[model samples]
Target chain A: MTAVQWILENLPQILELTVDHLLLTVPAVLAAFLLALPLGRLAVRLPRLREPLVGGIGLLYAIPSLPLFIVLPLILGTSIREPLNAVAALTLFGLALMVRSAADAFGSVEEDVRLAAVAVGHSAAGRFLTVELPLAGPALLAGLRVVSVSTISLVSVSAVLGITSLGSLFTDGFERGIVASIVAGIVMTAVLALVLDLLLVALGRVLMPWRRPAPRRAGSREPAQVGERGAA
Target chain B: MTSLLEALDWVLTADSWTGPGGLGVRAGEHLLYSLLAVGLSALVALPAGLFIGHTGRGRGIAVVSTGVTRALPTLGVITLVALAAGIGLTAPMVAFIVLAVPSILAGAYSGVEAVDPQIVDAARAQGMSPRQVLLGVEVPLGLRLILGGVRLATLQVVATATLAAYVGAGGLGRPLFLGLRNHDYAMMLGASIVVILLAVVLDALFALGQRLLARRPGTA
Candidate 1:
């Protein structure tokens, strides 16, 4: 059969795999952000804790995903067949990456701003909610968007671990020597990544309404430009 | 804890140290793939990044490509390339090179840009050529970020190269995947420790290298 015919016939399977991809990614990214925020705050509040805490997270991020996926089942005492292996490993990675970003996000809040909020009789929690969170919005959202893209692509990787996310198409095509399937998997993955990226950008715009084009000034200062977040 | 002990014991075994699939050979393969990818990527990306940083053009390409590259799944790239290219190192090479390129590109360009413009002006005022300004003024100061890119790319490739086992490139991933297949938790954990150890060691070495770079420019 021709490539188009094969893809046409397998449309349902591809769509199902896309859903699996989404399922694996969404929770992992959400869990990552939730976990990373506290760790980031802890690192920042206690300056001495910053290096080891952030470094530990970066070290975790450095572990190979395949090995982590294989070993997590054992670590969690679950069967290799469980989807939790993929989710847990991915979540750990997502957290590892996002921690530094989150810390930097909180650090982006100026000390004067904090003092100004205090002058208005705002409680600490109230200041964090009303003042810091909004100012930190761009970095936090940008960090999430980067991690979300990373997670989406990684979810397909779980296919080799026998989870059959969008990545299954690659394996299926390779095993059968069907070029269309592999090509379809690549195209679909790209499409998924692009779509998800757009959604995240839109979400960021809605949440952070003040991020409009600004005039570039001389020596325009920017806080540390984290890796993979140049756009933000 | 018992499983962890068993894994530690497994790594100490003499049998595990020698054979076609021994940790030594696998580590070598992992190193080779990571080095090949990072080295090739740096070669192309550094010069291009420097040019872009120096001329202040093509920044958008670097930024956009980095995003797109980050979003493209590494596993899919490996599998697709492996299938089409028919196994061996070709698959992993393509994947790792693609994965590593964006990082080195971004790091070098941004690093150069981060250099103090005043310093470049000083170099020029001292009758230095543009090339001299780049090499003498920009590169040394921006070395940190340029090296940061390499460090990040190396770590990424080291981690990702484990997929070599899946695509027939033969790295440390063998033990982990085979262990999974045979339900040998000890072997899986042992192999993972090896991969993790490699990552930690490499990261430390890079950090040390960065420190050395910092020292050199200051002393000079």
Candidate 2:
């Protein structure tokens, strides 16, 4: 059968699997955002704490996901093993990106804006909420956009643990010699990634409407500059 | 020397390296796969990134590619690719390439963009063609940033390549994955140590490269 025919044949299974993949990815991102935002704020306030926290997160990020999945079963006693492990592993990696971005967004708030807030007799909390956060909104949203997209892509690996998702379709498709399943999975994944990215860009625009559109042809130098500052 | 030799001996011993089904591959296979992933990633990401950076017309393409590529976890991408292509080294290698491309592209594009506009104007005024301006002016200036991205990509690829062991693609992760499966802490620790060592060494090399690149005249 043609690829199109195969897709049509297994559309329900493909959609179900795609939804399962989103379930795995979406929650991990939300959990990460919840954890990261506060931690990022804390990191900014106590600059000294930033290094150890970021370093720890970086170390966690470096751990191979497959190994982490394998290790999780041992620690968690294999009850709800696969999904739990996937969540935990993805959470750990997501933390690194989320925390980094949160800190960066907060840091990117202009000093002059903060000074202006202070001049108006704004308390520290007031300044952060009104001045810093407003300015940093665009950058933070950009970071979130990045994190969300990344989470979607990484969710496929959860399939290794028998957690059904688009990845499972891909694995099952290839393994079972079901050409339709494979095509369905790849198409579904690519579509999911594209759709999610557009959503993120839209979210960024909504959250930071005051920010100008990103320079169309700006080089990658800004991230490096940000990295240097963050590392320092 | 004795202690180091003993550690080396421990790593090379049959039990430490053997697979469950007696189909265990050599450490060299692991190294080969890692190298292949890194090499392919560099080859694809660097040029594409440079082209995107220079062209300045494909912002949407660049952004979307980086976003999608970065989002997909190394293991997930590899697993999916493996499923489509069949499990083995090739799938993981392709995934690693996909994984590595975004950072490199982002870096290259940014590096080129970061170049002072005046330099380009001067080069143009001096009768340099667009090719000459790119090759002679922009690329040299952007080299450090591009290198920085490559460094980051290399580190990421090496660390993530450990996942390849899951599909029977050999690497240092084999023992770690197997140890996790069998509850073998000694094996896990040994494998983890090797992976950590690889990361540290690669990181150091990149750091050195960054320093050298920074020191080049006119780069700053």
TM-score for all predictions?
0.91, 0.76
Query: What DockQ class does candidate 2 belong to?
Result: incorrect
lDDT (tens digit, per residue) of candidate 2 on A70-164 = 55544565532467678777887788888888888887777787788899899988877888878777777777776777667677766654688
Question: How much lDDT does each candidate structure score?
Answer: 0.84, 0.71
lDDT of 2 at B173: 69
User: Which run of 10 residues does model 1 chain A get worst, by summed lDDT?
Assistant: A223-232
**Deviation from native of the Cα of residue A67 in model 1, angstroms:** 1.6
lDDT of 1 by residue, B59-106 (tens): 888898887888777877888788779888998899999999999999
Q: Which ten residues in a row have the lowest lDDT in candidate 1 chain B?
A: B211-220
Q: Per-residue lDDT of A69-166 in model 1, one digit per residue for the tens? A: 86676668876567877889899999988999999998888989889999999998898888988998889888988788788888877777689788
| Candidate 1: regions farther than 4 A off | A214-232, B218-220
Candidate 2 displacement at residue A99 in angstroms: 2.0
The residue-by-residue lDDT of candidate 2 on B1-220, one tens digit each, is: 3333443566667775566422146345655666676677778777777766666757688887786566554654565577667777877788777877788889988887788766776787899877787788878899888887887777777777677777668777676667667765556555655676667677777778788877989675
Candidate 2 chain A lowest-lDDT run of ten: A223-232
DockQ of model 2, rounded to 2 decimals: 0.19
Model 2 chain B poorest ten-residue lDDT run? B20-29
